[model samples]
Target: MEADKYVVVMNSEEQYSLWPADRAVPAGWAVQTEPNNKEDCLDYINRHWTDMTPASLRKG
Candidate 1:
């Protein structure tokens, strides 16, 4: 990881800090959400996350 590769997966509206396995944690943390709706969930992450995940990579 060449820095800026930390991502956190969570489902709430709170913040926490963990030792990132790769890059430095962002302003707070990467907030992944499971919202009531699919778009809502995607929008939540899109709003708070950096577009660093490569478009061609498989997320799983």
Candidate 2:
């Protein structure tokens, strides 16, 4: 069996999530990376999203 493809998506609050490459992205979210295998997509998120706090809650 082949592995499923996924893409990294981000919302206005700076939250990142994985979405199926074959499906449409949900509202209020934008694609952040190209379609790739699930593992790679996860790695990308791990490397990039260091902070868990939302943009609105982060202090300057």
User: Who wins the lDDT comparison?
Assistant: 2
TM-scores for all predictions: 0.29, 0.89
Q: Candidate 1: minimum summed lDDT over ten consecutive residues — where? A: 11-20
TM-score of 1: 0.29
- Tens-place lDDT per residue, model 2, 1-60, is 543899999998889999999889999999999999999999999998899999889964
Alpha-carbon lDDT of model 1 = 0.41
- Candidate 2 has an lDDT of 0.92
Candidate 2 error regions (>4 Å)? 1-3
Per-residue C-alpha lDDT of model 1 across residues 1-60, encoded as one tens digit per residue: 333233345422343222333444455345453223444444555665454544335344
In angstroms, how far off is 46's CA in candidate 1? 0.6
Give the Cα RMSD of candidate 1. Answer: 13.5
RMSD of 2: 2.2
Residue 31 in model 1: lDDT: 44
Clash count, predicted structure 1: 0
